[model samples]
Target: MYPKVGSPKKVTMKWLDKAFAPLKDYLDAHHPENAKAIMGWMTYKGNFDDLYCYENRMTQGYIEFDRSGQLIRCSDNALDHEYELGYERIPVKTESIHPNVDRWIDRTVSAKKADIFREELRLFLQHVWGPMANYDFSDLKANYPLQGSGSPYCLYVYPSRFSKMIAFQFVGDEIVEKNCSLREYQKFEKSEREFMYQGWHLVTLIREFLAFEPDLSTTREVVRKGCEWADMRIDENTEFVLTAEARRMLEELEKEESKK
Candidate 1:
């Protein structure tokens, strides 16, 4: 067995909390309105007793608004498993990280909270890209994309007013289109979301970005298309994956600090 690294919660929390502080600090300072939650994960490097296990190295991959309410912070000990066509998924024995490194929380609640955050980014892209809006996401889907779960929230797009770039808010199955000027949209909703819906495993750090010139290429690529299944990957490499990048930057900082 691998050497114990404190408890799972303690070890994971130390890095997870600080993995995105600088970026988050900038966001809260400038764009408190667009404050966002960053979710990330890092697996043990290579095989056990190797680089990461010998000297902890952090990997970065994050998706904003992973789910509507609960953003699952996942850490998979990929060293123990392999992906084969017939490989059986080994069932974990406990909720503890030592025996079971995989962690996720799927709480059933309103997805509307994340729907608004999702729309904010969508609207921004729609306005800036204009004719080139679909360059990134053509449509928005609920974070938890399950049908008939009593969470009757559907993500529908608004026809562009191109006349004035405005962001609309959803209200009881209707869009509040009239008084939702872009300026007001940007200013309001200051309290839309936080990093933790309710913390578990000490994952409680937050971030918000005011301004950054982003390059939105290679966010998602069509990989291996079968009749009905296609593989899609999202990580810091993907476009608009800010949270992942945030954690990565923090880890880079940690590496630098350690050398000192």
Candidate 2:
């Protein structure tokens, strides 16, 4: 026979008094309007570890409001602090170095991964050349035909805006090479060789122009796609070279997708 199961018991405000009195007193003294609006309370139990495990900890508390409303505040009992209800803005002064660019450059320099660095450069070029080179967006066309012969590079052309074509030579959806050379559909070559050579790494090319560009929608999309493609190729033995911040951003993108 199955063991007897008890019906759930509803918790009342009186029960909450033992635990939330300090929080109540705080709100009563400071934000009385918020205090008066409280209708019910809830608690969360979880485990926390710091070198060792601590179980059955009351990790959080919440207050609910009436009129089909709620104002929730979670407490970190261990830290003795409440989470902020609203957002705060902290101003940072603009710097010459882009965070991603700096991190990528540092990693590349330290790892000495010249081939991976070059591949990243080609990917960056495929994305930002249109905007950085000031191509007319309205005249731009997606997935232009292949242009070159011996190397056979695919072109993402923006004709009538300029004579130069940004050639992205690919190897099975992965961009293997890129260049700004004139094609049969174009007239003159735009000299972007200095942009490529002056930089110690691929990030310098991006930091020079793309970072300051007003319209970076295309660049953002292309970079995200490139990263996704790279992620698919990663295995246990593969050393993923993206910086911590970049990995965090990618994780956030994954979280957003999961929510959807």
Candidate 3:
């Protein structure tokens, strides 16, 4: 499905070596078999890729590559590993043809910041939702705030499941918002809650902190002690007040009843 490998060109061993450097390092460390098995595909007569794409997910090659140089043609289901069956496996390029005019930024992350995204988010959630709360973030999706599509985790309470205490269907016109350090009853109508933009604002702050430093001091007052996601709704036309203290009392009462 790539543009017919329309205009293929050759790339140097140096360029190829540079482009795949990170993968080479990883494969060198971990994947000895795949490191040896991977092959370079070329168009007929020693030409490298002209245009490219990869994955049915279609996440890469979204925009046009440099139209003037070496590229790869990526077909649908390229992950299936069948594209090379009929293509020519040419020898590696020996000469540099065109100068890489644009500035090439290295995409490698420093070892200190590597692979800490999910862990940092987990810490943030635990600080807000309490140590006992259970959450499922397997479907969690996030984007840079105010820039891209915005993270889905910041849009809805469902796709990324918080425990039942914080995530549930609104059944009535009003719910008591409790344990958020309010001196009096805090009521939020369903319509008002819909517009609260609760998740959006929360995610924006988290994103800003992540992009700069991991310091979460700005959010210290908002989400501590299960307040961020805890809102008890009215039940059977009656207001339910289940603050953290009330839940603790209920637990003690249950234990006493069990003993009796």
Q: Name the candidate that leads on lDDT.
A: 2
lDDT of 1 at 222: 12
Clashes of 2: 0
TM-score of each prediction:
0.20, 0.18, 0.22
Q: What is the lDDT of candidate 2?
A: 0.33
| Window of ten residues with lowest summed lDDT in model 1 | 199-208
User: Pairing residues by index, what is the TM-score of model 1?
Assistant: 0.20
How much is 1 displaced in model 2, in angstroms? Answer: 99
Highest TM-score scorer: 3
Instruction: List model 2 lDDT by residue over 1-260, tens digit each.
Output: 11111112322444334224444554576667655443122221211121111111233333322212222333344323334635433322233333443343344322433333444333343345433544324433323223323212222222223233223322211122111121311221211232133321111123222323332344455544443442122334556589999999999999999999
lDDT of 1 by residue, 62-95 (tens): 2111112122232343111222435333322222
* Local accuracy by lDDT, each model: 0.27, 0.33, 0.32
Residue-wise C-alpha lDDT for candidate 3, range 1-260, written one tens digit per residue:
22233221333455444434433444366556655443222111111344332222222212122224223343433222123324333322213211111110012222332232333343334443222333333433232222333221222222233332233221111111111111111222332344344432232233333222224443444444334555433235555669999999999999999999
The backbone clash count of each candidate, in order, is 2, 0, 3
Tell me the deviation in Å of residue 254 in model 2.
35
TM-score for candidate 3, please give it. 0.22
